[model samples]
Target chain A: MYSILDNSLTLRTQLFSIVGSILLLLIIINLIRREYLKEGYSLLWLLMGGLVLIFSLFNELLFSFSNFIGIDYAPAALFLVLIIGLMLISMHFSVAISKHEKRIKELAQENALLKSMLNKKERKRKTSKK
Target chain B: MTKKSVCIIIPAYNEEKSISSVISSIRKISRRYDVIVINDGSDDKTKEVTEQTGTGILNLSFNLGIGGAVQTGLKYALAKDYDIAVQVDADGQHDPRHIPQLIADLDSGTDMVIGSRFINKTNYKASFLRRLGITIFSNLILFTCGKKIFDSTSGYRVFNKKTIAFLVRNYPIDFPEPESIVKLLRNGFVIKETPVEMNRRATGESSVTPLKALYFMASISVAILIESMKKY
Candidate 1:
């Protein structure tokens, strides 16, 4: 167990991490409140903020978890978690993009079909009048 | 028996130069068969020329790629209750002469008939890279689908009413030709191929360049694999 009073975590370092995580959460909440961010997509970001908050509050937890996992470097464990989180987020984005591509294609096709149908009907009307 | 109705769907993208000739050739075959040119957001005079020729025209608002264009045509065919829909390129590559043969096959029983360029050693001279893609795609299709498609990439095809109905719902958006074959076959649609000669492009360049060829291969191959593995 380590604390800010201990040499491992300085009070300034603790304050920085805690402030960073809180700031991230505040920005996210503000975006959601303003309808700039959908609640559906905010879950992952909120999860990230909460994880950072916990890691900052319990400064020794990351080191201890890394040690338990036989990781020689505590910072490497942080890097690993960050890389995995980013990979998951990127994967989520890819799936969303694929869905949007399918939807956009359908919409475009429908638009084309409708425009052409209208053109045909207009032409038929002109021919009938003649 | 009632006479069958047919619509020739030509998906054109900036292919105004050859489109007129293509439509006239089909008209020469038989004026009774309706022709509709799907001007796929062409920045040219394709729509005006097609209209001037007194043929049907579906001018897309924007380019939806070839797949979306063809699917739109199929949807229109379904709506108009056409008995058969034949897809022909507007670049004058697909000889409309073989269209009757393709429709005949569809009329006989086959849900779809592909006009294959490599089936009977035709005079079609494909580039080495093009031939490689065809061979790999054909083999991959055979291995995954358990049926041989000699010209899996051929866009010249005729679809019966039922097939058109299915395709309007399930056509892939990008590089859809090869993928659609596996999809239809997996869903219990009968597909056959007949030898048909292809003319050299009368205008524009090949859509598949060296760089795009890689993208074409990867995307269509993955799409085909997915189609083959899908259950129901």
Candidate 2:
């Protein structure tokens, strides 16, 4: 009875890993192919998906890595890596947002200035015509 | 020396009630200074009212906050090649009559001039908590820059061509008033403050609340420290 239960649990874990990793890979590829994600940003997601697939295919490697990191559970190690990856992605996004915000501010200022200058020129032309 | 062209920049947000009066008062002062009202994406009739006054209006596409509005004005000043730019509050707290005094101080070759209410006080009383925050910022700036700025929170200020150019390129976005002084000092720009009578706002509620005041104090302190650490 114990042997059969252990076998079933192992099969379920393997199936879950395979399905989850494939789904992640497919979604990331689809996004890139559709141009919804830029090449630069997609590189990170591709790397993350590739790592998940590698670990899922070689469960022993994941187990060893978890042991090396002193994590008792192998799946917990994957969660740890996922959290770090998300944090890095968020940090990158913050930097990009700051840069874009500065650019937008400069553009708005320029737009306002140009409009004012054009108005001045128009007024001058109207007065001269009169 | 030839007279320097001056542009009065009024950053108004939902200030329809007092904007017309402010523009008229500026016009009454003299035609020497051109008035430009920055309708900072006001939902009210601020743009229409300013238009009726016949002053130039820089209508922002969206709300960029006070710092963005002021920087827009500076950018305009730079592009238009105006020698001086004066910032006046559209809420009518800053008296436009004091503008000539600020300009006079700028004439002494200072890169920037601030119109202060605390230098020679009238009945301009800030709330106790707000005054505490201002005092703390004043001392922080004084300690860091070694220059006493009596009213660091006062937005009423004048910028010469050089200062205006620098600010147009790089100005603090949030809680800019006090931190800007630190930036100017770090860049080796000269700044002077003159006493100006500040009138109580006749209309419109102040944007700063008690909670915002606390946040303002913390953020401004951080900004001042970070700016002081910079080489330039």
* Candidate models: Cα lDDT each: 0.86, 0.87
lDDT of 2 by residue, B151-191 (tens): 99899999999999999878999878987999998788998
Query: Candidate 1 on B125-170: residue-level lDDT in tens?
Result: 9988788888988988899979999999999999998999999988
Candidate 2 residue B31 Cα shift, in angstroms, is: 2.2
DockQ of 1: 0.71
lDDT by residue for model 1 (A7-124), tens: 4557797799899989999998999999999898888888888887888888688778777777766656666777787788788889989999888877877787788778778989
After superposing candidate 1 on the true structure, give the runs of residues whose Cα lies further than 4 Å from its correct spot.
A1-9, A123-130
- Top candidate on lDDT is 2
Residues A9-99 of candidate 2 have per-residue lDDT tens digits of 2767887988998999999999999999999988888988888888778877777777787777667787898899888888989998999
Off by over 4 Å in 2: A1-9, A123-130, B230-232
